[model samples]
Target: MTEPVLCPADPAPVTLIGPPLAPGPLVFLGDHAGALIPRSLGTLGVGEADRRRHIALDIGIGQLGRLLAEHFGATFVSQTYSRLVVDCNRAPFSPGAMPEVSDGTAIPGNTDLAETVRADRVAAIHEPYHQAIADLLAGRRAAGLPTILVALHSFTPVYAGKARPWQAGVIHGGPGSDYGRRVLAGLQGVQDLTVGDNLPYAFDDTDYTIPRHAFPNALQWLEIEIRQDLLGTPDQVAEVARWLAPVLRDAMEG
Candidate 1:
């Protein structure tokens, strides 16, 4: 879907879908929970079939976000639009920020766009989400809560037909911290767990979430990745949540 339409019926669509439970050192965010292919955009060459791929959104981040929030008594923030419109994880400069192709699916709607159209995606989706995150972090800072930022995400097992073995990956931006170290240690006993420090992708300023917000302040944070197959369903989400809950508790307390 390359030909982008600047007007989406609803511009800013952020979904906070959980209780504002206890005040702990944890905050769960699903930067790509959105999967809405706005009605105005039409088909954009590829049909609804193509947009349903993992490239459009994190396969099961919404469920993961919810479980993490409830299990850890944390606040949750999620998006309600598809990443085919604009990727929340990517910095605005990254070409994939508004990708024309992801995995093997080509997004026809993202192809040709003038500055105004491009800016429209940013204004409608990116800015509002980032602003909300900023407000959350700011509030937590003022309230004296030890914030441990966790950006939940899921990755495809085979991209272009190659198998990926990492069941989970934790993206640690800074050198080291109690949060990152404890996370790695907690996950060590788990069988077949492939943990990547900067594996799939490293953190950079272009990453508006981790760098712009988490790293600059040296906040204890990690961008977590779970294999899509492992979390593509509700049962899967709950299982993964159980696997991660106690580890997160230790990180929050340690």
Candidate 2:
């Protein structure tokens, strides 16, 4: 398998596929899809070894987003820069903001960022991706469809020396609904698949994506995390999309 790139290019990295102004009842986001680092910022003091860590980007999510976009015909917006450059999933004020060190490598560039430089990142990259999201929501609302938010992500198989057994994790914001549960229930018994209602990282009101955007908009939300290895191939992505399509339809109708 080809190694995932550490980051993409600078100045509004990443790509938005499907429609930017679609009125689908669903919206898709891939926060850590980019693997490019900005030239000005450079790689955070982090070394080559650390950049490959889960800290960079959620591996395989780009593929999954493509599959999801095709399967659901939902507008998908994904990040193109490395998460080490700036965690797209994190709140702007959260300490993970511009992490100086990740996965045991000190990100040289991230240490002690100047106020102006930090704001540049927030404005140059972060704001545009989110604006795309806001536009999707606005379009959905305008069409009188109850929007359902689905954030695509992938996790490493092992972290910090501990083995992670979950093949997929389906996370819901604090707000529980049948949408989240029914999807989980549908994926009943795949071999070697251990599913977590919420695993690896949980969500919260203070610092998260689902609730921060979805709830306030009165949208249904489900955050899905596939083990990166499971989604490493195109076949895997297609299989997942095929499997989930009907399940999502059921959830929508339910």
Which candidate number would show the highest lDDT if scored against the true structure? 1
Worst 10 residues of 2 by lDDT: 1-10
lDDT of 1 at 217: 65
lDDT of 1 by residue, 46-134 (tens): 77776677877888888889888887768888987888877887886468788877776777788866667778778777888888878
Name the runs in model 1 displaced over 4 angstroms: 1-12, 19-21, 175-178, 204-206
- What are the per-model C-alpha RMSD values against the true structure? 3.1, 5.1
**Predicted structure 1, TM vs. truth:** 0.89
Any idea what lDDT model 2 has? 0.73
Give per-residue CA lDDT, model 2, range 103-145, as digits (tens). 6667778778777666677776776677777776777677776
